[model samples]
Target: MAFHKNLTRVERARLAVTKLICPITRDALRVIPLTDFIFGIYISSRYRYVYIDNPKTGCTSLKSAMAELELRGRKSDLDPLNLEVIHYDSSPLKSFVPIFPKPTLSNLIKNNYRFVTFVRNPYQRLLSCYLNKFDNSTAKDNPQARRMPRGAAPGSFSEFIDAIIGQTDHDMDPHWRSQSINIHYSRVPYAYIGRFENYATDYVTTFHKLGIPADEIPTLRHLNKTGAGRASLHEFYDKKSQDAVYARYQDDFVNFGYPYELPD
Candidate 1:
């Protein structure tokens, strides 16, 4: 579909080969996950901006806002709240690998593109992931949840932490994956790394970095909020769960500068 169109020629060719060999390999040689990782990286040549999406870290709002800028005040078919539309090929912001050849992308990365991403506190991010993806209301419909091993109780936050402790970032869903891994911090030279904790102000800085005029910067909207009421981290986290999450995403805390202890 349009989503698959985001695959570069090389990626498409790789996928084709993987498809043929996957059956023989009992689907052990899957490339779809890697392709999905690439899909999280959106680029706009017109704006000279590259946004690496960190799921559950204000990505929907950021992408939607950027799409608005890319569309140049025109109405967009992509909705911030609609995951399918915002992420698909029809969106104004294009995936980097698919839109530019490797050499061109390398040049742009080295000399032009302003790469930016937002990261949330690991504790909050994991809680949000569970509330959105593993809750009884959502888990049955979520593909990632289905693929996950059945151990965590439908809405048990601590169990959810237990369920994914050993999984590598490559195999884990981006929503709960380490923020540093999601953004490939070691590999990508980020021009700005905003914190989800300071979303309102940080996004304005991001829009300015993208060269969006102050008057033209779209109002940031909160999209894909999980559950109703204020779900505090303390309610779901205890010494064990907090320590487990810290161990799992310690790199995120270190790389993103979030404190190890939960904030009051």
Candidate 2:
């Protein structure tokens, strides 16, 4: 790509890995046993669209809309907002069996289906995860999560970021995991990856890519609110914490077009 000519070596390398790495063979696709742990992947053999849901990036709403799309078809008589998620949940470890036959799962991956997902600014996503999962004084989480100091969120954020930057992708939760790591660029061929920065506008374009008309798409709904009781990303990130986010999730920033520098 001509764009690659202008990118720095590191940026170009991330691009190369994201684009060049994932090339799953038909035989491999055929043998991947469907299970509950395949968290956010939605395969619609009916519409031939495969959606990989990135948690905390409007996944619940997207999955619900997708569930209705699968159940009601492209021209849904049902409302997307009223629809429920039958196949997917945010729990990274839980999985759902494919509605399609075992053999058909292979064809869906190998055939005409468009594979799509949305990504967010990694720093913002990290903040959202902390607020939703750790900042809460009431909710139960991983025993490790309980240890992140509250109130002094920037320090906690910095501490948490440091831990995961050194850890493997699977070792961290999806909310804190690197987007590039989640997608496993080398093995999965995703047809479209949109950014949540331009969510409403980009979503219309994404819906079209999924073979759904813009009119057919519902008014985008907000299902989850990690922001309600907490401060936004801006309030929690100091210069040190900001730099940590940049260093830790730079692949996401470079690949997804987020600014490298944090806002003042």
Candidate 3:
């Protein structure tokens, strides 16, 4: 309901980060890849838009749309999926390279060319991660799993939450890491931060904020969706487990305006 506000989303986000996140988190977040282009960081040099890709929240789907846009004037050599993959074909569209001398990255953020990212409710995102990644037997086969404390996938959702809370000494898995830590809006500040729950309106609002025409914005592909769509998070959590989750991801809930109180 609040698109095109007098104070922009970027302005509000920068304020929220400074006020809500402690100095320690702000420092930790700043020490990340300058652009993080290798992961979900999608940038369009032509349009001057940056989308910080958060895993489990429409990463591949949005990437597909961006991939299509990348081919606008360039050669249409790669197919949709290949375009999303980080390769030579996609290089021309990238806003910045992941390197020390990142003038392109600095210019974009400093010049304010519409940085954006999507977020989901912390509880739903956790359930999606469990049902999609940690709950599986084959997750240990993932490259990052080799570095996990257990050297294998968490056997259950409860165990996964424990892993997140307990694995302070090791790198936290990005799929389940705190959104506040990942986006670090205080440090970089997004022009628009859309919610996955309100994907329809917020998705449109993103382009609107960027001054992109509605006709040019393509529909997002629903990629890598996990488990039954109807399954409620309430089913997976007991009061105790739910409380554990709240303790673990309290900042996410508080920052995103999500309810953490356990259902009656």
Best by lDDT: 1
Please give, for residues 6-95, the per-residue lDDT of candidate 2 as tens digits. 567764454344333323422222323112114545666666777765767877666666665565634435444543333334221123
The runs of at least 3 residues in candidate 1 whose Cα sits more than 4 Å from the true structure, single-residue gaps closed, are 1-32, 73-82, 99-105, 150-155, 227-229
Give the C-alpha miss distance for residue 83 in model 2, angstroms: 10
**Pick by lDDT: 2 or 3, better one:** 3
* Candidate 1 local lDDT, 1-264, one digit each (tens): 222536677766655654453341113223226555557768787888778888888788888877767776566566544566577666677644532223233455766788899988888888877777767353345666753567334447776787888776656777776777677677677788888888899999988887778998988888877742267678888999888888888898888788889876
Local distance difference test scores for all models:
0.70, 0.59, 0.63
Error of 1 at 189 (Å): 1.3
lDDT of 3 by residue, 1-264 (tens): 111325466745643454343342335434443223235455777777877777677666666766676666676576656634533334444544322233333456766767888888777787887777755536436754554677777677777777677554126666777777677655656788888878778877877887778888877667777852456767777887788778877788888888876422
Give the C-alpha miss distance for residue 221 in model 3, angstroms: 1.7
Model 2 lDDT, residue 80, Cα: 43
Model 1 residue 163 distance off true place after TM-score fit, in angstroms: 0.5
Candidate 2 Cα outliers beyond 4 Å, as residue runs = 1-37, 73-107, 141-155, 228-232
Better of 1 and 3 by lDDT: 1
Q: What TM-scores do the predictions have? A: 0.81, 0.69, 0.77
- The CA lDDT at 231 in model 3 is 68
